[model samples]
Target: MNILITGATSGIGKELALQLTSKGHKVGLMGRRTERLQELKDEIGDIAFIRTLDVTNHEKAEEVYNSLIDEMGGMDVMILNAGIGRIQMLPPWEAESKLIEVNALAFAHGCHFAMDYFRNRESGHIVGMSSMAALLAHHRAAAYTASKHFISNYMKGYRQKAKRMNADITITEIRPGYVWTEMTERAKGMFWVAPVEKAVSQMVTGIEKRKNYVYVTKRWQLLAWVAKLVPEWVWDRL
Candidate 1:
């Protein structure tokens, strides 16, 4: 598969590029960091292509994605993994709004672009990197959690759209629990945090299986089940 991954500089995105390319897949990598993307391209050699792109830059992102697809010949999957996480509300609306831009709006931009590209071809996969926070919102990370909720819900809607369109477009929503990545290295009260490589391995498996929803590390599936049983009053109190 020829796959394009946004935010491929570090964390799960970087790991996904390495792992997928190791399995003989061509990977188109995009990130804000040129040096890191170069390192990945060097490491992966002919199978890896690098583009410096900030996914929030909508116009540039579209150009970058199309350019990579042109370079790769074709793209089989688009992983919308570019996102931001905020653990506080101290700075108020500005920081929160930026989180919305990257996590929600940029994600939507990627999704819309990928859907258009795939629909024309009649077959493709779209992966969205959401979080367990999508199920259980946190007070300290209100914007971050809500943004993930948007990701998951938006993907669900697209899944339905794909069905109605009768296309072979797979929309996979990855809801992962705490994994020790650059994004969550300083996060407090973390538990059952899977290694980034391990998490991405499970994610790769899920993507290959064409699963609609994947909970990384397997144990997180139990949490997802419990979350649905929690009452609104309980969540409101938390």
Candidate 2:
């Protein structure tokens, strides 16, 4: 399969690129760091094709995605994995808004492009990197959590739209709990932090199965159920 992954320079995106390439899939990697992309290409050999650009630059992201899709002989799947989450409040509204831009606006951009491509081809998959934060609100990172909520619902809307249109496409939302990655390296007091490899392994399996939604590390599935059951009073306490 030919795959495209945004934010492929580090963390979950990087792991997905590497693991998928090892499985003989042609992977198109997109990120801002050209040097890191080079390093990944060097490690993965010819299977790795990279386009160095930030997803926030909507025009450039769309341009590079189309070019890379053709470069990879057309993409079978596009992973809308580029996102940002900073544990800060509204005092620094810039940081909070930036989180919304990347997590929601940029995600919408990628999803729209992928949906268009899939609609034309009548076959493809769109995978979104959402978070458990979508299920529940967080105090310190209100914008981040809300942005994820947008992502979760946005993907669901796309899924429903595709179904109604009778389009042969799939939307998979990956909701991960804490994982040990550069994104979480500075986070404090995190629990049940799965190793990056372990998290990616489960993610890949879920993607392969084309599941509508998946919780990383498998154990998070239990938390997901419990999360839905919590009342407002209990949720406020947590």
Candidate 3:
């Protein structure tokens, strides 16, 4: 299958490109770092296509993605994996606003492009990188959590729209709890962190199965249920 993934410089996006291309799938990767993109292309060899662009630049991103789709003949799957996160200290609006831009607006850009492509073809898959934070609000990172919530709901809305239009499209929202990637490597007080490979393996399975929503590592499903079951004040205490 032809697959295009945004934010492929590192972490889950990079690993997914590696694993998928190693398995003989044609993969297209977009990232801001040219050197990193080149390195990934060298590592993955001929099956990989590399384009350097910031996902937040919606117009350029669309052009690059459309070129990738054309180069690969067509895209079977598109993964909107570009995101940013940080623990706010004070005067949080700056970080919060950036988070919303990268995590939410960038995501919408990719989703719009993919939806248009898929709708015209009548068959395709879109996989979004939401987080378990979508299920609960985080005190230190409210914007990050809120952005993920936006992603979850946005994907669900597309799911419903596709159904209404009788389009043969799949919307898969991947809500990962904690994966040990560069994004979380410096994070303190982390819990239940799964290895990148472990998380990606499960994520790939869910994508292949075209699941509407899935928690990485499976065990996170328990946490999600508990999060919903617990009362607000009780949750705050934990």
RMSD of each: 1.3, 1.5, 1.5
User: Candidate 3: lDDT of 30?
Assistant: 89
Clashes of 3: 0
| Candidate 3: pairs in clash | none
The local lDDT score (0 to 100) that residue 222 gets in candidate 2 is 94
* Best-first order by TM-score: 1, 2, 3
lDDT of 1 by residue, 1-238 (tens): 9999999999999999999998999999999999999998999999999899988999998998999999999999999999888736547888999999999999999999999999999999999999999997878888999999999999999999999875799999999998889989988899999999999999999999999999998999998999999998898897
- Tens-place lDDT per residue, model 3, 93-146, is 877888899999999889988999999999999999999999988787788899
- Put down candidate 2 lDDT per residue, 156-238, tens digits, no spaces: 99999989765789999999999999989999989999999999999999999999998997888899999899897887877
TM-score of each: 0.97, 0.96, 0.96
Q: State residue 152's C-alpha deviation in candidate 2, in Å.
A: 0.5
Candidate 2 — number of clashing residue pairs?
Answer: 0
Regions of model 1 farther than 4 Å from truth:
87-90
- Quote the RMSD, in angstroms, for model 1: 1.3
Task: For each candidate in the order shown, give its overall lDDT on alpha carbons.
Answer: 0.93, 0.92, 0.90
